[model samples]
Target: MDYKYLLLVLSLSVILILSTAQHENIPYEDVPDICAKCVCLTAHDTDKRYHHLLSCTSKKFQHILARWPEEFGKKHDNVDIVATFSGNNIELLQQLPATNATLTFSCRHCGIKYLQAPTFMDVPFIRRLDLSWNEIASDELTPDVFRGPYRVTHYESIALVDLDLSHNQLHALDRKIFEHTANLTKLNLSYNEFRVLNAPTISALSSATELQELDLSHTAIKSLSAAIFKSLVNLRILNLSGNDLTSVPDKLQLIGRSLVSLNLAQNPIARFTEESFIGLKSLQRLNISYMPVLKTIGKSVFTRLETLKRLDCSHNPKLVEFDLESLTHSSNLTNFDISYCALTTISLFVNVTQESHTDIATLAKPWPHLHTFQSIGNPWYCDCDLIQTMEYIGTEGDTKINQARCDTPYFLAGALVSNLSSQYICNLKIPKQYKAILEEPPRFLRKRYIILTVIVAAVVISVGVMLGFAIAAIRRRLKRDDFGVEPIRYTSVRSSNLSAFSQGNTNSIIVNGNGVANASA
Candidate 1:
């Protein structure tokens, strides 16, 4: 009886364990009190439709269930497109609501650590998903991380368009990580710890052939292979800024025909040769700014980007030489920023009536779309050589003249190039040696010259008066000697008198033939 009773007790325990496990898996009917404040949205565009939104942003919600609240899709079946969950502390994402309604979903800054496979498998209409600023990595991930849920009644692949995984510690990825999503377009993986994009990872994303924009900025990638982006022929925008790339890869020619925008700023690229961007004909906006190590850009570097409209080369203190003529090939170039380069001069895209002179109005015709040109923070020489450039910028009125300052000849230092007087430039046209004399010197120098002249004249006049007195005394002595009786010299008396007269106290003097003077005080 004891044995039979023990078996019954063990059987009951097993039944109880199964029951508790089953209960946890079932979806909850009532909304959690914490999530009750989420705003259920209504369609604003149509006014008749119900479009729902569930925002639990920054709510510090710790866990999510394996299934959404029961009947959430059925009750609000008319709703479409739920979007945005910013600044939350959600740690785990196990599942998503089973509906073709959600179009956009963002869980940025959520501190998410674990995300179960098939998280978005049931939601077939997710267009945009942002999981940025999380602690997501590939170590805890499986090959089927994006696989859809099993035993699904509805069957369709998720129509995910945009995905942002930026600011995460995702250093590696599985080969089949993105295999399920074929229609992904814009993918941003910036601010991550990707050391290199290997062949397996590149192959995984190659299925997304319709990709338009891809941003890998601030990722520490050191090198690239040609086959990495060969499949993305239709890619339009590519941002690889803030990396350790030494040179641009030749593989860029693969998407050269369709690519539009490229950003490689904040990198340590040493030079930009003719082959740097050779085949990118359709490229428009190019940003190569903040590259401290960049020093040289070849003359024909930009000759191929015929559709380029904007180019930013700012904050490169070592880059001194630039060939603006290379940009003339890209007729659509409109916006240009070459600020903080410590440049002394630059050539524009106009014919010279005077040598090196640019006529902004005449040049504006060929490049009708060219409008903004920024050259600020450069050490400009504002002498006669730059007068034409200054005059053109001032007259065009449409051109933007950033705070380009003078840095030469002491007098022009710290003064703005635009504010320089035209009269000063005209005077500078004369030879520099002659121009100094023609132009009035600074007031301090003039005062110094005047004081020195007065001191020299006073010294010369005093010497002249002393010489005149000495000559008159010598002539009187000679006349006395000629008219004397018996040639009496009176040498001793004259010597005493002359010695006393030499002193300024002498009141009277008598001179005899013996070169002496007698004085009475």
Candidate 2:
């Protein structure tokens, strides 16, 4: 009896193992009835339920006649359906099949050109629709393209919270295009051909009062209407990069109450006036990088940005002057990037006086809360003021400074600002009266002095040798006069005396007192 009981237990254990294995390796069922080329499966959701996922991607289908299996909702307990029909050749989106479950549809890169009216009439519960990377034009995007049929009294509105229409050929949208998507929270219109977002197009988006994020990048936008974004009161993030804007969009104060992150990069803006970013009281992150023609950030340009934290002005090749005092109002700045610009000094940050050419005893610290300061890739002129500023930054708090290498004062060129001392930087600038206390000159100056000393010594040695040779020649001439053969002397001898001299009479020849020749005689 005991052996039989053990055998039964072992058999049951083997059966349980086989069942678990079969469950784990169950093949995803194909839903040919809905989309001949699609696969439908139930995925475990975070809410402890299974949601239907209908994937029809990369199927070279021209159209889909979705007819969900009769028992689909019963099997999945009426859970949501996330459908993807991307990478297809569907030119017109007429309508989606009726379904009992909420839907999230994506048809990216579908070559879709037209969206027919009542496109979502049968599936009015769509929460997200992505039709990006299509050939849809402005004229085809009629106001009722996203509309559904009426329920009983009023028209049924879509539950759409996110809509992506990027990478299309749309230049202008109908004035009431978003009338059915009033619940939209995020809208992406990037990579379009909108050279100018006209007033009517801006008014069309007023119905989406709940929108928080909008992407309009790479749209070739040259300017914006004064009230373009005025109705988007809840907008938090706005991207206007890769445009042709010459200045900041006007009347940003209309959305100043809720705007947070703003990106204006890759534009041709030349300068920022004091009122450039005015009324942006709630802004935190601002990116103005990659502007080819930007040159100056004028004083108080960032005046009203008291809540600003991170600011990126990097990669502006012509950006030379930035009024650091303009950042005084933004004391909460934590990350500041000014890299790859044309800045030549850090005196603007340290508030150094050019007239005095002296370091301040108590420097004005602009960004007290700054933690990440990237200032590299600039033409930094390392001087007394720069050294002091860098020293103060290095010792104050835990701020991280990516110091720029020097580009001026030939001696300190290519040297990191953090590695230099005030003595080395001020060696050439110290007053002559205080030279006694100054450290040795920089290596380049010392090298110059050594070369100058060698040249002077060589010159002096040459002059001394020439003078010695001249003096010796003079002395030898005197000695030759003293001991060499004396000139023939004749002391006024008469003709008779001359005859006697000729006859070798020694007494007739008379010499001068100094024994010098008398040519007159």
Candidate 3:
């Protein structure tokens, strides 16, 4: 029985060894050797779709591979492949490698000056391409450089959704350069050398009807064409900051229906006219801060912005005049930031005069939904009108008043508005109608008055008591003198009589009853 059991065990062991060898002989996909110096990762995107990323950034490579290895896309079915070749010294962007899988290509900061035609012909499924931070000029981009292969004898465009060509030497583009990218949605051309965006140059982008976001900041653009953005009906977000625009671009109503956010900060805009943003009814957030020459925001500048929620006009050193009534038209305004400006005071009533009574009914309620009001870093004049306006706003809404320091009236300078009483802020300037709001004298002042009154009363009482005592003493002295005067007279008469008796003249002599005065007569 032991010999039989050993034979059975040996047979099972041989079967296991043969099975392992057979499994090892089966074909399995491995990482391609062309990406030996690159880091490969299989990660998931925001939609939970798995994709392969090959990063070859800062590898000191002077050239890119002309073609990818065969069977690369056959191994991974329905998976995207993204290849990056950024921060290399490759001066020329030649034909790209072919791949059957959906591909995304990026080659930023490669010092590339030339782009050969038909660059992406072999990469039929290319979706996104990034060529930012290169030296490609306008003349280097041929018309057919972005075109893909034709499908079913008719031109079928590639599936490119995003293209970034920012930070290049491109001054202009051919009107037909982007004809093949009908599905493009986002394009970044910021930090380029566009001094002026002429109508023809802007017309080149009219074909991208689906484009939503465009960045044109810091391009030294002086002005825009009147109808430059009229064709981009689907455009939503636009960044025009850090430019030389002296005023709002004309004819913005062309894209006003679809625009949601606009950034006009760091410009040289002097003021906003009543019709500056007339047709932008869908706008939500606006940033017009950091303008060195901005001065005024007129009364009707924001009259039509009923849907605006946030407004940032901070950091303007010359912005001294802002009509508080201008905000009354925007009923849905929530966050307002006017910090670091030159605003002295903000009042809801129009044409407000100092030292005058304000009717409660006349005061309008602006910013009914206001929550945060940032008024710090400004020279606020904490007068009665300003205090009253703030109190009204605080009571009507849930907005928190910022702790702005006073800069006028000399006495309240550097004092926080929240810590100051309305009476103290207004002092004698408070109107007669609102005198009931004035509080009693300060605690220290009341204490000082009590002390002074007590001292005065004690001095008066002490003086009265001393005067009474002096009068009584004078009366007693008078009585004593009256009683002693008759005796003195009697003595004088007796002495005189005695003298007369001695001189034999005793007619006027008088004596006391009990003690007889013996006369010599």
Model 2 Cα lDDT, one tens digit per residue, 216-319: 89999888876667678999999999999998987778899899999999999999998899888899999999999999998878888999999999999999
- Ordered by TM-score, highest first, the candidates read 1, 2, 3
Question: lDDT rank, highest first?
Answer: 2, 3, 1
RMSD of 3: 22.8
**Model 2 accuracy (lDDT, Cα):** 0.78
lDDT of 2 at 415: 91
Q: What is the lDDT for 127 in model 2?
A: 85
User: Mind giving the per-residue lDDT tens digits that candidate 1 earns over 346-447?
Assistant: 655333444334334344444556577788888776766465555543435566677677776556678877777544564554334322244687765798
lDDT of 3 by residue, 1-521 (tens): 97987887777568546744643453322334755767777776788666888788988767776555432444544668888989988787776766666889999999999876667766767878999999999898866677776453345576788889999998887877778788888888888888977655787777678888888899899887755576789988888999999988877778899998889999999999898998998998899999999999987898888778899999999999997777777788888889899998888753334444344324655666789887888887777777766655553345655677887655567887767644445555633322222458876579788898889999999999999999999999999788565554335655665677797665545466977765544
Instruction: Provide the global lDDT of candidate 3 against the true structure.
Output: 0.77
Q: Higher TM-score: candidate 2 or 3?
A: 2
371 Cα displacement, candidate 1 (Å): 2.7
Q: What residue pairs clash in candidate 2, if any at all?
A: none
Model 1 Cα shift for residue 134 (angstroms): 0.7
